[model samples]
Target chain A: MSLELAVLDWFFEPLQFAFMQRSLAVAIMVGIICSVVGSYLMVQRLALLGDAISHSVLPGLAIAFLLGVNIFVGAFIAGVISTVIIGWIHTRSPIKEDAAMGIVFSAFFALGITLITTIQKDNKIDLNHFLFGNILGVTVGDVRDTAIIAALVLMAVFLLYKELLFYSFDPLGAQAGGLPTGLLNAGLMVLIALTVVASMKVVGVILVLSLLIAPGATAYLLVPRLHQVMLLGAAIGVLSSVSGMYLSYYVNLPSGPAIVMVVSALFALSFLFSPRHGVLVGPRRGRPWQKLRTLLPSKGS
Target chain B: MATSPKIIVDHLSVNYRDVQALRNVNLTVRPGKMVGIFGPNGAGKSTLIKAMLGLMPVVTGRVTYGDDTLAHQLDRVAYVPQRSQIDWTFPATVWDVVMMGRVKKTGWFNRFSASSRQLATAALERVGMLEFRDRPIGALSGGQQQRVFLARALAQEAEIFCFDEPFVGVDQKTETVLFNIFRELAQAGKIVMVINHDLGESITNFDQLILLNKELIAAGPRDWVLTRDNMTRAYGGHVGFFGHVA
Candidate 1:
């Protein structure tokens, strides 16, 4: 076969399976929503909050499964509940926010594990599937659900762009300027919870923070504005996710970890090569290898 | 813009968790005047301002502006919090920060109108930050950051202007710019209030002084509020004024 034909064949072979198509669609949607919502978390220094929300969703998932409810709604409720509890603990006590988040997430996660373990005895469900996603097992319904979440999240972000930007940048100033800061905060919390719930199947709760933070953090290094960071981060996220899906099909690796590795690698590459704030490249305004100039003999010397 | 009214904070009290931040503080900030809030450390200068703006929950009294409560009419107020209260490293350009002033006026779910852009542009130019509009806020110096915030306040075009510690980290040039704009705002029949802890020569810039120490010590013209008795009362003893009064 010709080289082009072989390449095309390799790519086309995966689409032959309905499962691959569904997983890819879900992955793409997860990628976009996670990055957009995660940009807020990353900027607010709430990356750990993402972890807290993701893990806290497990108990809700197990309970929903027992009660025969939509797991997404349950997961979202749990995520928001965990956030509120974290806030309550931090405010009502001298214990700081980080400590509160750590305590609440662990307790919820432990309860989730116990619940899932007990439920697993009577059902065919596996805890590993939730901890590490089984993306290839996603159905057409998963694709539709993920698409709805992505559309809603993107629309909310677009409509509330200016308000969210102002609130996230300066909460007190936003409050003083008559922005209804409490409502805006609750809206953001909703956006975050919805994003976390949508991302649960792609990276699982264990690895969701990577999908949430790494892409946005990477784009942050390369951009100078919040919207720019979110846009570039979405692009990075989508590319990494789709490529990871392809890599998994060809390399026989787990889809979730493969996606995570790709995004992490992208972050590492950007961390060292970003034009303005790179370690080795220094800055692109000068030269790509400007830092290497130190090793070379100087003309003045 | 014909005549600005006074902000009547009547017997206002505030608490910080358990401790009393401000107690039964009663003062009136008049328009067409530059008012300075001066106090020592932990003297509730910021708290008094916050309580007046309804940023904190009051325990005792009401802060009324005109006929309505001040909290109900926050749109007429422009507040620039202390430099330490903000996170400058967040991803925002100078233009973005200044445009936040228009967010309230433009309303929600709507794009900024042309007049909003014009106001933001004029504000940036007023503070000499028009050239740095595209610069990331985190990349600016302390004074430049403060200037951007001042530009934001100017863009607000509010009836009441409140600044908290605007001079804490600014340069001489920025301080002069701030005071000049403040005086101009006061001349335009606008209410300008600033929280400052400086016992330096700049105390003379304010037309009125509000000396505070958990409560209102003295409030009136500069000389009247800077009496030796008031100073001793507000600052515990062994303290000096700006050499303008005993």
Candidate 2:
């Protein structure tokens, strides 16, 4: 068989399974929203915050399952609460923000694990699915939920692009210019929480940071502006998700780890080969040897 | 726009953790004059501006502008923080940074209007940064970065302007451009206040001076505020005021 035919067969065979179709749709939606919203995290140096929120959502998900409510809603509330708690701890005490995040996320993660373990004894639910996402098991409803989240997150990012850029770049300047920075900050946190909840079903909590951070960081090496970084990052994320699903289907690999590996691979590629800022392909700076040569007397001298 | 409003900081005090940063800092800054705030390290120079702009919580008195508090009228004020407070390595072009000045005026959920872009372009051109509009902020020289920030403030078109240490790490040309624009702004009946650490020859550019050391030591015309006694009070006798007479 021709290589082209083999490629087409590889791509089309996955559509034959309903699970693959649903998981692909959900993956694409989550991929787009995570990267788009995650650009804010990357530029603001809040990658750790993304990890914190993602982990903190697990307890909310477990509790929501217990209450028979929407896991997404519970996860979002938990994520937001964790951020507030972190802020409160930082402000009320001499503890810095990183320490605050560490304290809050670990406590929430521990509670989530304990709750899940206790509930698993009586229920059909598997803790492993929540810890490591079971993308192959995504339902049509999950796809719909992911789509809605993607639309809302993308729209909020679109509407508030300029304001968010100003706030993130220079918050004090934005505040002094009469931009309600507090409101902007709260709005950003909501967007982040929503993104984290939407992404939970695709990559789970432990690996969501890769989806939220790697794509944007990869794009940053290639782009010069925030909007461009977000745009490129979304493309990279979608490509990674689709290709990762394909890899999982063909190689029988775990879907979440596959997606994360692909995104990380893309980041490594960009880090080495990006045109403007790449380590290998970018303009070479003066090396130590060159500096020494310039410092010492020239051969003519 | 008639008789540009004056800024009155009255009996304002600020406490950071357990330390008192500022105490009863009273001063009146009027339009059409350039005021320089000078003091030694840890004298609450930055805190005074932050408190006045309501960026920090104050324990005592308030800052007002005519009938309204300064915080309420922040739309009319443009404040540039010290360079150290900003992360310059963030992925942003000069154009992007300059356009941020118009973000407030353009309102939320709205695109920047044509006139706003024009103003930003004009400000960039005025600062000789139009050619570098597409350049990332991290790639610029220190002086160029300072110029870009000044352009952003100019694009704000505010009535009251406050700059914290604008001259630090800037080239001579940037300093010249900054002072010229400041003088023009002050001459146009705007209130221009700068927090400067230097008491060198550039001190002559200020029309009035506010000497501070956690409290208001002296405030008046440059000569009066730069007296030897005031310098000694503010700087703990390490500073020798130029033109000071024994």
Candidate 3:
């Protein structure tokens, strides 16, 4: 009976602090939106684009701080700009999309680091918090901002679900069928940018990719349909976020990395145990050992 | 049902970077006929269709259906890109893909109606893929995948149909199923155009042929387009005379 009470106390203690409440709210909102939008990236094989957009937002955030504007607005603009530049470079030249992404992201990331480091020397900003999120430091306003972004992103995804599915699955066919693929592509970029901006306070730039990709990918192994993947992924993301927050409170770990580690651990568990696609218990589970043995010469030889 | 329009291409040209992929191409496709666009590798067979549908930038002229530009009337058209262009591993069941056909007709921000669901089901049945409706697209064989796309086009209920390389890696059963549906669509007075690279037995299935090699070599009935001189012009001097060789 005492042990049960202690467990309950461990869970309830964090709710006492207003800062913890804000952080948990922000984490949950970020968790839901990131995975829902990230399912599109996973299905389209555009995971790197998520990374590019996340890194590109740093310069925008820094610039917004300098100009006294909402940092999310600045981050969104920078993310959109990076995508346009990447598209321009890929379409106008022979450089492939991946190379364009790599070039644009690294350049933007470097510029962001330089700008943030310079500002940090004079201002009270901590570069570490920006690179690896400061979830515990999120304020009530930040929670509200995340909620608005989350609502907008989720609404857009819901309304555009069918179009996005068609466009991402077969772009040329969708274009040929008279779907405005260019508009769809741009709208998708906007959704991705909003998601990345909303996520920055919870996972930071460097670790955001795991939050954006791992949940959806893990759900992909378990679900057969796109909407199912999104649903399951959002659930997984929310559970991980809340549990990671409690783990951080109890074990004295950084909240952002702890959340990421929890999400990664969940992905690993799915990777090894999913019924249809798992590495350890799937259809061809034992065949690898047999194949490996076949590679060796027999005793007669 | 709306009457299918007569397709007219007037002096169409296409360029990729510095090279002219298609030059001074012209053709006329009337309703109630299966038109096959055949060419060798890099012959711009796909480019011609893409340019006509406004999928690619046209360099010279325009494509029209009856009184309207093809681009403006795209809602009445159904197109299937090459199978290789699609990501089969995408997380969608066959039912989900077939429902995509109803997306345009259901309009933006509107849910698919019950009639739309019935149409999708009928299309799946038409292609003999009703049993696999719930299966993931990636798990199907190449032939089954092609049939699913064909079912999607059928569900669109469009007046014009365009297929790019529908027979590349499909089995004989799928080819026969596809050709039967193409013939039915043509018989119903819908314009049917298919991009084909093979000069095999399937060549005889088309009612009209548009033989091309960067430019229009021949565009007419099958017998006229498959002439020795036209074959040599399109395939570049490596012709062995076949059954209808000129």
Model 1: docking quality category: high
Chain A superposition TM-score, candidate 2:
0.94
| Runs off by more than 4 Å, candidate 2 | A286-301, B244-246
Over B1-246, each residue of candidate 1 has an lDDT whose tens digit, in order, gives 479778998989898988999899888889999999998899999888778878888889999999999988899989998889888878999999999999999987899999999999999999889999999998898999999999999999899988999998789889988999999999999999999988889999999999999988999999899888899898888786647774
Calculate DockQ per candidate and list them: 0.82, 0.83, 0.86
Total backbone collisions for each predicted model: 0, 0, 0
lDDT tens readout by residue for model 2, A1-301: 9999998997899999999899999989888888999999988999999999988998898899999999889989999999999989998899999999999999999999999899989997777877778889988889888888889999999999999998999999999999899998888999999998887778888899999999999999999989999989999999999999999998999999999999999999998778887665665635546644665788965
**Candidate number of the best DockQ:** 3
A1-301 in candidate 3: lDDT tens per residue?
A: 6999988887889999998999999999888998999999988889999999999998998999999899989999999999999999999999999999999999999999999999989888887887899999897788889999999999999898889888999888888889999999999999999999998888898899888999999999999999999999999999889998988898998888999999999999998778878776666656646644665686776
- Per-residue lDDT over A1-301 for candidate 1, one digit per residue giving the tens place of the 0 to 100 score: 9999999999899999888989998999899889999999999999999999999999998899889998888888989999999989998998999999999999999998999999999997788888988888887877888888899999999999999998998888888877888888888888888998888888899999999999999999999899999999999999989999999999988999999999999999998788878766754446656665755698976
| lDDT score at residue A13, model 1, on the 0-100 scale | 95
2 versus 3: better DockQ goes to: 3
- Chain A TM-scores of each predicted structure, in the order given, are 0.94, 0.94, 0.94
